[model samples]
Target: MKPRIIMNFALIITLYSALTFYIGWNGWIWLHTAFGLQDKWIFGVILELISFSYIIGHFLKGIPFFKVIGAYWFGLLQYAILFLPLANLIALVLIYLNLPTTTIVKWVGAFVLAAFIVLFLYGSFNAYSPVVRKYSLAIPKNAGKLTKLRIAMASDMHFGRLSGISHARRLVREVNALKPDLILMPGDIIDDDPEPFIQKNFGDVMKDLSAPLGVFGVLGNHEYYGGGIPRYLTEMNRIGITILLDQVTNIADSFYLVGRKDKTDRDRMPIEDLLMNTEINLPIIMMDHQPAELKQAEKNHVDLLLSGHTHRGQMAPNHLITKRMFEVDWGYLKKNQLHTIVSSGFGFWGPPLRIGSRSEIIQIDVTFV
Candidate 1:
């Protein structure tokens, strides 16, 4: 590499390393602060170092969205960060000098600023993740055939302390409130090893979820990496979300819900088998995580497909990548024989930072005349 280019590459690596560590460790810091953790001095911190391996693995797998974020906003964020440490020091000094000021007022100001930052980040990520993303279609209704088909869609539940029981119950309640005849979980149900929560009372949190027809989920790329597919599958089964691996199912006597495995699966998804099994007369709806398989979905004349892997690129300016990589990025679109709706999702997986995409639950109302 040329001298300047080499230096720039070095600088980029340094930044990536620093931020990944911070992202990894921030969870540890929160755990300590939240419950007054009394473990080994460095237990949480060590886990942070280990978690960076996933960062390295993600880069190896060619996560392209980060490049997009760097191209657009890295310059501005870097500029802000240059002054951030100094700003913190200056604030501390001011607080110390104004010791006569009320401690309550200062503490309240600090908390208010922190809450604003959290809210700002959350709202910026706001995409329409409706528990019922309503839509209409015309199908023939028999004397006693299925009239209205309901679909409940959810994604990106990180499943740590924050994403545990309470979060799942609330989202599931929101979804069940729509009374979906069918349910779909696109991917990333349990962010990492759901084992910690699953073993405790947390697993019961998901049991309250009920769908008249059934609930099905696919392996997100995270499930494969975090602890392996079977581990995630075990947890889901315990909670009763059926695992669909390159499988297709007929829904409500008119439509087909075919869930393809995540693109990360090297075993080769049996798209042809799925098509062969389903009735050609009925409209087909597919659930594939990446939205990377447009040609096949188009060729198959699928009526609609739902996915949530993009999280609308999961961060700001990065959502542009979802547009570039897939014909449909993070919302509803149709072409040729395909109608696809991509949900930005209901939970944050990594940094608790959602910049460009809204956290959501998608509801698609399928109808027969």
Candidate 2:
């Protein structure tokens, strides 16, 4: 790695370690005073293990228990980082007011616990409950004899250990119910590892997803991280779903469905180059996993662009960052003649919790003139 890359990585590690230490220290103080616990070594060890469990589980794929613990810890860690300092500040104020130590601890602890519980409950509901977000738009170009097309799209399914068989079944049931003429998945179809998806037989559940115009998908960054593109493609094809990697297909001579390699792929073709051979006269619908290149799609005359991968930050306040990161982070955006629709995603990444965003599927009704 380059010197700058190494430096940045080191900085991230240092920051994570410092934050984890802060959280652990506060937690230890709470336990010691509130519950009369004095075993500092045990607390420190456990905290460290939990803090790094996600990394451990990621590399050692055999140990799923660590991943589960780590996933929940991550959700807690985010809120803890946000609220813990405030709790500490409040405690300091209480001390200045000459409040009893026990009373101060009790009040702060109770408030923090209640806040965390409410966030977890609400966030869990938002993560698990998938909603259909509908969009109706018109294209000036004609698509053969077809005047309208109903496209059902779900991106960032991230099906793995966290989002298992139940989520897969729910997705299949939901999309099939929509009875869309076409189904498009803009990616992150599986979590980092494809083993869990295959081992748990999620393919069987997903194979039930039905659409007459067929189901198509492109890879997200996560797919590249997993490095199981060939296997993922094979499994998806087996289930009648096509994983299109920088490829285009004409759909019944009506419209073109273009799927691009993720932005993460260094060799990913440019929009103009990818469409060079294609007949642009037809209504062209394209899927690029991340909504980072809307201008390129619009400039290339892509009629409709589908994407996800934002998750709209997945948690609150985080959406603010994503909003600035991507032009259209969560919903629809009209850039000139191009119609871009980006879903918040049907699944999540780290924690199966969503604060500001809900798991969603996009149902787009396209009318071609």
lDDT top scorer: 2
Minimal lDDT window, size 10, model 1: 71-80
**For all candidates, what are the clash counts?**
10, 0
| lDDT of candidate model 2 versus the reference | 0.93
Q: Residue-wise lDDT of candidate 2 within 1-369, one digit each (tens)?
A: 899999999999999999999998888887887888989999999999999999999888898999999999989999999999899999999999998978898779878889999999999999999999999999999798899999999999999988878999999999999999999999899997788999999999988888889989999999999989889888988899998889999999999999999999999999999999988799899999999999999999999999999999999889999999999998999988999999999999889999989999889999999
Query: Model 1: residues >4 Å from true position, as ranges?
Result: 1-12, 15-132, 138-144
In angstroms, give how far residue 85 of model 2 lies from its true place.
1.3
- Per-residue lDDT of model 1, residues 1-369, tens digit only: 699999998998798767645433433444445545567457745644443444443454344344234322332343234434454455467668875334533443455347546744554435223334555554343313676777778876766543456566678789878887777888877765555456555557776678888888877777766665676677678878788888887665766778787888788465766788676667777888777877778787677778887777766667776778877778787775567788877876554456666677777776655
Q: In model 2, which runs have C-alpha deviations exceeding 4 angstroms?
A: 1-3
Q: What is the lDDT of residue 156 in candidate 1?
A: 69
Query: By how many angstroms RMSD does model 2 differ from the true structure?
Result: 1.1
